[model samples]
Target chain A: MKRSDYQTEYKTDLPVMVTPLPKTGGSFRFTLKPWHGFVILMACLVSSGIAYAVTDKENASIFEVLVRWMPLLLKGFIFNLVISTCAMAIGTAVGAALGLGQISLHGWVRKASWLITQFFRNSPWLVLLFFAMFLLPFEITIGGLTIPLPDWVKAIIGLSLPVMANVSEIVRGAVLSLPSGQWEAAESLAYTRRQTLWLVILPQCVKRMLPPWMNLYAILTMATVLASIVGVSEVMTLTGQALSAEGGQTYWHRFTPLFYYCFSFTATRFHGGRYIWKRNILLSTKHCLRGP
Target chain B: MTTNEEMPMVSIKDVHKSFGDLEVLKGVSMDINRGEVICIIGPSGSGKSTLIRCINALNDIQQGSILVEGQEVNDPNLDKLELRKKVGMVFQQYNLFPHKTALENIMMAPIRVLKQDKKEVEETARALIKKVRLEGKEDNYPGELSGGQQQRVAIARSLAMKPDVILFDEVTAALDPETVNEVLLTIKELAEEGMTCILVTHEMAFAREVADHIYFTDRGVIVEHGPPTTFFDEAKDPRTKEFLSQIL
Candidate 1:
């Protein structure tokens, strides 16, 4: 037996040989190595722990502060949850309409929709929140009916203004990014313009529309702090009050994905803001990746 | 069988189309008969593709009416989608949906457009896959296939809709040398089986072999049109002869 080489039945001076094999799919093939994966995982965890420990030594940890005031933290966390859910629902519905309107064939409709998105997106969210709370009527009468738009309405309007822009851009780009032929292809299949938008175009666009959706949600949580100036007893307002009482050197708004959910009434009640924020961030990431 | 023997299947009268200040088609007129394979050969920008697209209501004509199967294609009140259902189109790029699997792409138009039963569409889809000689590759995406295979899938997807007339907008211009024969042969077989096709093609040999009617266009006008035999063998237009000589 030869150790170096195999003896062939036929030898030829040719460029190639024919081989029948199954076709491979995709740009490149990947293989799983469990041992390598485990090593990488352990290394990542060890490095992250060392990094966090160093960060804690330099500053007083908010995690520890929230742990000390667990009861009040829980209260604030609930307020944070309410603002995000309400704001996101309002933003998505309004944004989808604006995005579709901007692309509408009608000249006036397209122009009107484009103007609204541009104005809201460029203006500061905090400024808009101030206007909604301060300038809007106390008891507006419409058709002999008296109703209050409420201070909470200001919070949602502020949060939704920017978030709607984000959602509108996402939806518009998703709709436009679809191939020009999808419209023609749908037409050839006997799908009406409205039916194509609902069935073919929107369904196809949703899969590509999810990742950016999370960023808009994260921004909505941060924007809720604007409610504090409006006398809304939301989480941020309560947290500011706690810091003012504690005689802390200074408190900067922590944008670590979540905050406390405090209920806003005439009297404010605090909850464990830390725990709720953590859950919100975790749930949001999962929802965004796994889809609605 | 389209029962419009007295009236032409597709009728275009005094058609004019423009872009900005430039006119692409200038007062063109033609009638496409029922169950006919017509080859439209011309110089670039002759508005051949646009003409067919207007027939399907994909492009709007500026100053004329286009009728498909004896119905007005350009009526503002007419359901453009329903009008398009009877007119299939094949592009130079073979615009198959990249996100869908091959079988799913072929099945979508039939199920969505015709509202056919899922089982029936699937059966027809399988038959189409077989007809295009793409067995064991139903699950593959269009992006995974070669240019030839993608074009074939585009062909099959249009076939699934069962359009009255299929418009070929230079479908084989994007294929490679060896693969061109495979696609042209498939088209030849279609012509033999009585598919009413309007082929906008660069391959003169395929046009000579399969076209019942041939129209040689030059700068948005039909310079000459007749039976394939006279049109190719003894072309009266000097521009067509000059064009054919450069390619051949």
Candidate 2:
């Protein structure tokens, strides 16, 4: 008999478990297992309702104010996301290169990676961003001709600088965690050292490295709102404009807290991760929902 | 190297290798014709493993020389990939890719390094797995197989490369006593089929049973070498007799 048929024949005495478990005290096992999920959802709705009721004094429906303000808020959120994603992409690339460069046998390459990483990590991000936006535009020159980058470009570079430092460290940690034997094994197969690192070691490190990297992405997304200080019109900036509007502004300005909360939450997309990825580590932000 | 008359497939001449100040292999040399099974028995850190590893340029040595089937080992001239293609190695740890299945592990070297035909490599890989009596375990990952089975898969993986010399680096030392038999049997079966092999092992009985000749290595030097019967029966070196007695 074939392997499958052999298994089936030998498994004749094994029990089949097709039918779902019977209801337990008026709820099924699957539903019972989702208690934490249900509780979180109920908690979210309750807090959102309470915040909407107490924080905003508008006599109109919360929905009406939201609808009027939605376009500008959405544009701001999309703007923030674009900036963060682009900056983080550059950060990751630079970081991986720096990490690899730092591990080089050459003293100069190691020193170069060290200095670059240190310069970004020790200094303040906001100061760098502000300086780049203001000073860089006037001071720098190429070929005896002075030219300036645009505001948004400077802002992205400045914001991305700090992120690159952290990414390099993370990449370095992942690379170092691999056993030395793994490298030797590849070498034993007569692969060159560089080929061994690229083919065998790096892919394994990536799988183990992704969780921390995703968490960093969340933190980076939150930090990118600082870009609005330079008139980049990120979510918080749009909120300020809506609240203190001269023209093309809505009544949703009075309900800034609600709109900001919803905007941040939705843009960050903090939902449905349990079934899809199954490796969530963040605790619930209940106070975030309940706060002004 | 073999043809009942040709140059030895591998020849090492006063080969000396060191790591920094720690000299490991000091003036060690050996030669083997094609299709001969030569087993190198040694105490720990005796450089038997390092000698075999050096044959394919796995580790570079500072002095003397090694030649594989006419190509100088440290030859700035030889293509490394081509040199490695002719000499396959099996590690004590099996070193099978944990993420890939047994069949996939066997197929990877052939497909990736040799660039062999996909369908042909698949068929050859299947045949190799069967040769090692791991027919039902092809789709299983290395982690899922027992140590003996994994080592056999590793051996089959080397066989898939169609190498002239297969270096076995203490291939059965990591296995359990019961499992050691299966692995030794698999290797013994290979030697009987006229595969050229260099086994670095402590299983003196298996080494005696399978090896055409035996060499006892100590402190990075080949102390004695002879036909297996003479080496085991009348080991002249005091160190060799002591080494054999302890392991036996």
Candidate 3:
């Protein structure tokens, strides 16, 4: 039946309830569920057991070696998390400003902001990281007091450069996507440009920006491994250390670190996936409830 | 320069407007008195919507002057915020903020921009919602309301400013056929209460019923204008007659 026919037949004052139709198409698709992390962890454990069984009887068990190094590996992984969190925070704040600048009424401000965004976005992350590491001073003297710069801090600064550019593009896209009628309506209501943007425009942009912003965070988390190359001693670098310290050329030792990295990244991605899934459900239900 | 009470609410003098080389309004002039309801009817692209948009300086005119309550609309030094407060507008699309409820949409500008007392503004907003026949749906967002309901909320939002003149630019154009009458009736009631209103509409019957003066515009200029009784019955311009025959 037609939607209008349903409305006419009901003839009620209550808000109409619309149930969204399920999507069609039967191609095989793989989506990460909340329980996928546990499955991956089990696979890693079973493989390590098989490796331990095949190894020479004189050496320590693979599980024993993995357990011994677990705490140190987790410490490095936690540091990676800290860097990712701080970089995302700084990037989002600065990127939001740069994005707003792209839409500025002044031609110079818009052009300069666009240039900065493009410059950082197109540059390689590793090149930017190397630049931050080499170009910055090891320590600075201010009023006879010295403050030292850490390697992880430098890595964060490098990673956040591209994050800021992507976020700026996201913000500009979200703002421009709104109907121009919104501006006209707000202007007709006597709101200043700043008030209209902050009050009407940005509030709506937040919903559109959230999913992509979270996706960026996940990609940045995986990119945290890049910091290992710069001597930040994150998970990847520590895994290399743990492998050599074990003093063995066994297959289990070689295969163990890969699982550690995979498991940690998967765990983080699982959390992000759950959040985005819940948000999509909320948004779809909202769309269904909205009137035609 | 005359006193506000004696002067026309809005006065346009030989206004000419263009968009990149295409002239949309050519030498259009009219005076709208206090408490008068004027409707400008024309074919598409006749500049009827453009004319009302200019009254509040939403669009700049290349030449000529538009004065709202004796204040120059096109003056470079003129405060548009203050002018907009005096001359409110309702658009065809009813661009209500999706984030705000109907009541909040009405109360927002007064509280935020004018810095009014929230308690008093809330009372006035509630009354306006009732006036627009949206009492039970005050908390509903614009997305939850029908097109007509959203348009009524738009009118109430404009009225909340208490402007000297209100402009409606095809306010009912986007409404469903079943809901158009509700919006028209609300506008008609506002006209009956002697509010000064200028409208650009295709609703000839409603224009005849409510308007004190009717203007027929064609090709960027007013072809004919008079009271609805005579303008519709005795149109002198061939363009006006042909336009009326096609629509009516």
Q: What lDDT score goes with residue A90 in model 3?
A: 91
- Each model's fnat? 0.48, 0.25, 0.80
Give the CAPRI rating of model 3.
Answer: medium
Q: Provide the TM-score for each candidate, comma-separated.
A: 0.76, 0.76, 0.90
The residue-by-residue lDDT of candidate 2 on A1-292, one tens digit each, is 3444644555553445222233348654342233454465556555645666665454455456556777888877777777878888988999888977777779999899988988887878888778768776544687898776666677778777877887887778887887775665565555665766776677666655666677777777777768888878777787777656533334334343343344345534543443343321111222222322
Model 3, which residues run further than 4 Å from truth? A1-31, A48-57, A143-145, A247-285, A288-292
Best by TM-score: 3
DockQ of each: 0.30, 0.27, 0.62
Global lDDT of each candidate: 0.74, 0.76, 0.86
> DockQ-based ranking, best first?
3, 1, 2
Write one digit per residue (lDDT tens) for candidate 1, span B16-104: 88877878788888888878999999988888888888888777878887888878866788777777778888888887765678998
Better of 2 and 3 by TM-score: 3
Worst 10 residues of 1 chain A by lDDT: A261-270
Give candidate 1's error at residue A4 in angstroms: 29
Per-candidate count of clashing residue pairs (backbone under 3 Å): 22, 0, 0
Evaluate candidate 1 and give its CAPRI docking class based on DockQ.
acceptable
Which regions in candidate 1 have their CA more than 4 angstroms from the true location? A1-66, A135-150, A251-292
